[model samples]
Target: MEKQIDNHYRYLQQHFSYLIRQQALLPGEKLPSERDIGERFNLTRMTVRQGLQTLEAEGLIYRQNRRGWFVSPPAVVYNPARRQSFIEYVSSQGFEPSTDLIGVTVNPADARMAELMKVDKGARLLFLQRRRSIDGRPVLIEHIYINTALLPGIEKEDMSQSLTHLLRNKYGQAYHSMNLIFKSTALLEDAARELGAAAGLPGLHIERTNYDAAGRVLELDYEYWRHDAVTIQIDVNDA
Candidate 1:
């Protein structure tokens, strides 16, 4: 029985994988329901799920909590070396991008945030949270901190638009330099829920510090992304 289950799961994986590679299943196309798949393959639902999980791990597919599995879209190429906004980069790559402002607040910075922004511990900081999507698929959740003292009245601007564009147009400010740190970890519950992803699912975390021409920290951005939704590409120019 165990051997039969092994072969069954492998068969399921290979069958779907072949169809995906042939483009018979286009990106974002939904696969058959798990019960249907199990019925077709004469396997248990649990076995079918295991096979689907295998495909998901290979980045060939993804599953929403109750939405079933879908063929994975092409991963958006992300270049930290380039100073481009989410809307700009995603559009340049022939993908639609959108941002939904989740929440915004003005609050005193904690000791850690104050040290990072180089402001007084009790200084007001603008906190902005947004969910960014590619091709109508929610792929990123942003937790951004802005040094309000540096850019007064910024909180009044429309928060859903591109921050990079707003900074340049409204304040005549652009990032002169930036610091980025990355890690692979389980998605936070809040982020996962916002993206319709399963809690504890593996995802990417990015911490970014943007600086102005005078070397003052302009913004701090924390981005959480679906692991399969993007590929980080950075071109370094040492010369």
Candidate 2:
């Protein structure tokens, strides 16, 4: 009986990890109760709990007192020198990447937006907003301000797909983005709803200014990421 219990716990842990990696268990989503897991697996509640505890120790999941276990959001690390697309960075972590377009339109530049993108006041600009997911879990929300002077036909673009790919292939543009700043913030009501996160919870806020080959400010973007679901990796060489 003891051996059987140990095996059951191990099996449960393995299966749970698989679900997490496959994104079947989404970030911020509560895991079924131990009793529920046991009922499904035909195991004892203790056995199910052992599996969940292992995941918690690994920082892949968390238990909030009586709130139950949930997938942990990613951690964010700021590296000033790295240049990579958000998709590329996320994919390298062995997760499926997807984006949900929230809003996309061309509009007159506002005072602040104009200053950020270095476009003129009332200049036509493109606004793109999206919610990004990994393994079917919402983790980040991004808003992009693009100067229409550089890319005139943005309204006709199908940005429900990859914006980076579009810029690279269609415009023959190679963009290198620099991180202007990053800070931690609490989720607003709108952001909380989109991410299924609790309102006022901590999130990672990133502000970036992207440049073109001629050092022109191509776009300015803001990204809000789930604090526990992502991490930045960087290696430093002697300078």
Q: Which candidate has the top score in lDDT? A: 1
Tens digits of lDDT, candidate 1, 33-147: 9999999999888899889988887788989778899999999999988889889889999999999999999999999999999998999999999999999899999999999
Candidate 2: where are CA atoms >4 Å away? 1-69, 73-82
RMSD of each: 1.5, 8.1
Which digits, one per residue and each the tens of the lDDT, describe model 2 over residues 15-57?
8888888999887789898889999999887778778877765
Q: What is the lDDT, from 0 to 100, of the residue 25 in candidate 1?
A: 98
TM-score of each: 0.95, 0.70
Q: Candidate 1: how many backbone clashes?
A: 0
Predictions in order: lDDT: 0.93, 0.77
